[model samples]
Target: MTPYIQVVTTVADRTVAERLAAHLLEQRLAACVQITPCTSWYRWQGAIEQGEEMVCTVKSRRDLFPELCRAVRALHPYEVPEILASPVVDGGESYLHWLEQELRPAKED
Candidate 1:
């Protein structure tokens, strides 16, 4: 079987982060999501800047990434939201299996 994965999305606001978390889980795009509050430091146009943000760590099967990404894009409030996905190289077999099962579409037999 293919690897399960965890995608990390950092949003500019808490409400947007919560909404994205809800949308992904409700649509079965993710098995679980963890929202974290973070102080973001970066450059937007040119100068260095900082802001408050919330990050969502979403767990799912890697195969569902495209659909999951699409869902985030559709529901995201930002003009360009940070959607980052990473491979789950190693983990518990049962947990990975569950991730796959959770991400599988109901329309599939």
Candidate 2:
């Protein structure tokens, strides 16, 4: 798998989503964050529910997942925030390079 990953989370509204995105970008925790409106249906507290939400897709390195999760939890209003990561197995070379450049430098072992 590639060193890259995409983290996803949903917030109650566009404002909160934008704030979360900005925080991640400002902290260099994400190279890019794409926000989009979405309709969600899930079981919460043993009851079926539906809501309009904004999804934030964060592009960053896999190694940053832990820090990213912490950052999201800190700002997310939901008691159980959704923070999921999926590996980027492949991507356009130039685009990947740009993504890497935009993110913070990887820590040395």
Candidate 3:
């Protein structure tokens, strides 16, 4: 497995995406979160639906995936949110090191 991964999820609105991003950063679950607006089409409840959405890309270490999934699910509004992780096959050595550092949990006394 690769040392890093990017977790992607779509939210109904920009506000939701921003909130989720902020929460993840505050929790140190992600090194960075990028939110982008896009149009999406998919089937739900046997019906095809189309809407404007915000896509959130969360960058973090591969080992933190489980926790990242749980965090996104807890903050996501959709009953069946689209959460997927793609491995970073190769990245800048310094950037990868920074990502790993950012995801480390805070030390407790």
Report the number of the highest-TM-score candidate.
Answer: 2
RMSD of candidate 1 to the truth, in angstroms, is 2.4
- RMSD, every candidate, angstroms: 2.4, 0.6, 2.8
Q: Return the TM-score for each candidate structure.
A: 0.85, 0.98, 0.91
lDDT of 2 by residue, 1-109 (tens): 6899999999999999999999999999999999999999999999999999999999999988999999999999999999999999999999999999999999999
Order the numbered candidates by TM-score, best leading: 2, 3, 1
Ten residues in sequence with the least summed lDDT for candidate 3: 100-109
Predictions in order: lDDT = 0.84, 0.95, 0.90
Name the runs in model 2 displaced over 4 angstroms.
Answer: none
Candidate order, lDDT descending? 2, 3, 1
The 10 consecutive residues of candidate 1 with the worst lDDT sum are: 100-109
After the best TM-score superposition of candidate 2, give how far the Cα of residue 101 lies from its true spot, in angstroms. 0.5
Could you tally the backbone clashes for each prediction?
Answer: 0, 0, 0
Candidate 2, TM-score vs. the true structure? 0.98
Q: Tens digit of lDDT per residue, candidate 3, span 1-109?
A: 5578899999999899999999899988899999999999999999999999999999987767888899999999999999999989998889888887788754445
